[model samples]
Target chain A: MTAITVDRLHKTYLVPEREGGLRAAVGALVRRRRREVHAVTDVGFTIEPGEVVGFLGPNGAGKTTTLKMLSGLLHPTSGTATVLGHVPWERDRRYLGQMALIMGQRNQLQWDIPVLDSYKLNQAVFRIPDADFKARVEELSELLALEELLRKPVRNLSLGERMKCEIAGSLLHAPQVLFLDEPTIGLDVAMQRRIRSFVAEYNRRTGACVMLTSHYMADVEALCRRVIVIHHGRLLFDGALEELVHRFAGDKTINVELADEHPLDPAALGPLVDGHAVERSATGFSVRVPKAETPRVAARLLAGLPVSDLVIEEPPIESVIEQVFEATSAEVDGG
Target chain B: MADVATRPVSGRPDFSKVSFGALRRYYVGEFGASTANNLAYRGAVAIWVVTTVIQPMVSIVVWRTVAGPAGEVNGFTSAEFVTYFAITMLVDHLTFIWLMWEFEWRIRTGAMSPLLLRPIHPIHKDVCDNLSYKVIGLVGVLPAMVLLVIGFGGDVSGIGVVQVLTFLPALVLAMAVRFLLEWVLALSAFWLTKVSALNNLYFSLFLFLSGSFAPLAVLPEAVRTLAHASPFPWIVSFPVEVALGRRTGAEVWVGYLAQLGWILVALVLLRVVWRRAVRVYSAVGS
Candidate 1:
């Protein structure tokens, strides 16, 4: 079964608007004004069971809004969505029990008590039996490295520790669907990597469908094979992560190391890569060419130069996503 | 890697069906957690009890001045004045909820996101939190009540078996009515960014109409009639009046009816407003 099926899901909010200064404030007493913000519009995608899909978007690009709609925290202004065959907005207990929404900025754990106690509360709320709760807690504790954290109050833990404990607490229910919005936000690089790996392991162990949205592309690259990109409240692209990269990256970077350790000049290897400049290094040269021209460029470089090693790689996902956002924004603004 | 059928999830015991055991377990678990949370800030709970004690003591002193010369005013002795304020203070403590003050902050700060994500209705957590505060607060309040009765000479002369027995149930119902009423009002934060003004209006009406300001008998007749139109008196004053043996026979029954009526009304309003409030919240992005 498809873990999630969203069809033309849309959401809009009426935001109160007012101008600065006392005159406007005084006039506002007599009347109020508001503007409609279309947060997510006609965004549609299906995430298969056990798939870890990345929801990629720039700020105000409706990634969180779509996640909220799927998690049952918000209702769409139009269209429909379902997770595990149940409409999310209905907030059915069956659906809720099978899913978890973990926001890095928000905590679901009780702050004043030990993380273990908070898990106990969840156990009762989720109706997990005593033996199962103990075993699950142990498993999550081991996975999240929460041995010391289980006894410590959430307030007492450091940011990374608390976030780790928070993630562990969210997963105690072993939800089949997880919506992780910036789950690695504000953490150190190492902590972020730790969280990403924990998510991957959890996904592997439980077969839960995971949809993650992160400003850190590393988080997505580490876990998601498929990605859905949205911009200006509209779905811009949806496909495999590699395909997204190829479609939007526009260029592929090729780095070559000369067999001899002499510095190479850019013009020496130029006119080979569509007149594009090559950046020379002590070891070799590096150049970026159009995505379609990557193979030809790499071949020409390897055959033409005393190349010891040559590697062709797609541009980073961040640049690709940014390009997607900027292009869509331009089209939206221009139109 | 996505096969949880063997390690499948468990749905919490839903309350759609009547099951006392499940109800007891859930409430007890929540209550324990809430109690632990409250205990973490024992100083705050202590300070809260102090604030609760101050208002009634002030009211008692003011009313005592009115009965100065003869120790009696409007057919009531000075002792009765003390008793009235004392009971009002206790009832007020039992029924008051602070969510109206916190709801605006929660919505603005995005603190409400956690609660909304949970499977259970948020009210149950709030209810347990309220109960935990009261239970912990009673440690300070009960002794204070005893001392106030002894220090200020509060009379227990009219007290009897029936009054105390009936007061218990009325007090419980009043707490329910008041809690639900305030929670419904707290939902106003969904639309308004600041709720302090609305909360201030609510408190002022409650003070005036609920007999916390003065006994209905001593207040003007028109005000008494107005008090009947609102749930404030039923939540705070009527319970106190019952405990004092002031309301008798059909009057006692009428107060019960009013308390029950308010609970039902609050329940209906809570359901309707809560439904709309969630829409507003989703629209507002908190």
Candidate 2:
């Protein structure tokens, strides 16, 4: 079943533009210049229950704006989104009860109090039956290893520890959907890995639908098999990560190890393969070819060189991401 | 997963346990923690309390001087005037609510978003914080209040045990009425980014109309009528009147009835305002 459906979502903001210097500042009091920014434009997607989808975008590319609309923190200027068969922006108590939004940069925990007290306070707000509240808190504490941190003031906890508590607090009600906005931001590698695995475990146990937005590819690669790339307020691609690479990217690199030094010039090779080739050593060079032409290029390269070892590998995902943005910008400039 | 830290305890309890037991555990420990917090900030709290209390004290001195050599002015003897303002000081301190300022800060700092997401209305936490401060500050303020009354040479001979006992409920209701009313006003923070000027204007009007300056009866009939129509007089002056035995029979009944009316009005206003305010906040990003 579909847990979420967002159709043609659009959000526009009227932001005031301020001019520098005393004269403009004084004039702004009487008249202000306003510009409209379309943060999300004609975006649409759906998530099935238990599906983990990564939302990839650059800063100011409307990732957070989209998440805010999905979580009902914002009202869209146009179009609609429904989570668990209810319109999110209506923010019905039932919907809020069944969903949770966690932002990495913002904290929901009370600064001066123990984490347990804040959790208890949430129990009252959610009106969770005491028995259920206690059982959930104990379970979360064990899952997140929060036994030691529960009694200490949140201010005393390190960033990583605090993030764990924050995550645990949000799940006290066992929400069916999670909207995570850069959840691993600002944490060290070890902490990030721990949180990532914990989330994967939680999703496996609960089968909760998750929409994750993050700049870290590690987080996306670890948690999401499918990713939707957005830029300039538009959805660029949506499918499995491998499909994304296949659709927008060229193919593999043929890395060759030669037995002895040989004078080889990449330009001397025919057609130049329309890609990059580099020497790893005096006799070693890597030649890249489109996936469709890999066999033909390998035949020529192998016949032409005294190669001892050869390995072909898919290009790195980071390069593909950079190339995707470059292609998008080229399209815009060409238009 | 079977080797969980503890057995899944049946967290449910009977109805009695939910209401009394939960509040008891929260308040008892919360009270201790709040006392320690207050002690840590005693220097700042003392300064704030002194500044706030001195406003009433200054009003007493000014009214006493206005009465001059004559024993009575505007139906109140100089000594009675002293008693009135002294009682006003204590009542005002106890009844004053800062939810307006708190809500303004909470909304502006985006703190209200987290509070809203919580299952409880943020007011419950504020209630605990307020009650805890009163308990902690009572140690210092109670003695000082008695000293001021004695030093001013006021006539409190009519304040019997019954009036003293009646004062407690009157004060608690006054606090409730003030909290709800101010909380409704604080919702204005959602719509208006700058509400401090509005707050100052509201308190300034309350000062003149509520007999914080002098007995409402002493004010012109026009202002007194307005005060009676509003909740200001019931919140401050009614409690003082009951404590000083100024109201009897029908008057006491009417005073209690008026407080109930104000409570209803406040409750309705809060519901209406809170819904609209949350709608507005949710419409805009926090």
Candidate 2 regions with alpha-carbon error over 4 angstroms: A32-34, A127-135, A250-311, A322-335, B3-47, B68-73, B217-230, B282-286
The digit string of per-residue lDDT tens for model 2 on B1-286 reads: 6332222223423322236555555555455555555666788778867766677678778878888646677678777877888888787877777878887887777677666654335666777778877766666566667766888777797699989888777888888888888888988998886699999999999998778888987888899988888889988999898888887668877878888889999999988887778666632342
Report the poorest 10 consecutive residues by lDDT, candidate 1 chain B: B1-10
Q: Write the per-residue lDDT of candidate 1 for residues A171-274, one digit (tens) a residue.
A: 87778899999998899999998899989988887788999999999998899999888887888888888888777789889998888765565666676777
Q: Per-residue alpha-carbon lDDT of model 2 for A1-335, expressed as tens digits?
A: 68999999998877789878999999999998999989999999999999999998778778888987887667788998889998887766667767788988887876777888778766654556666777777777777789999999788999999999999988877778898989989999998998899889888877888889887888988999999888878999989998887887786888888777676666665454444555456558787777888877777767877878888887877778778988887897899
Share of reference contacts found in each model? 0.42, 0.10
The candidate that achieves the highest lDDT relative to the unseen native structure? 1
Best by TM-score: 1
TM-score of chain A of each: 0.92, 0.90
lDDT by residue (B1-286, candidate 1, tens digit) is 2233225554544534545665567789889989998999999999999999998899888888988845687677778988888888788888889999889888888778778877778898889999999989988888888888889998999889999999998999999998999999999998887899999998898889988888878888899899989888888888998999988899989989888998999999999999888766763342
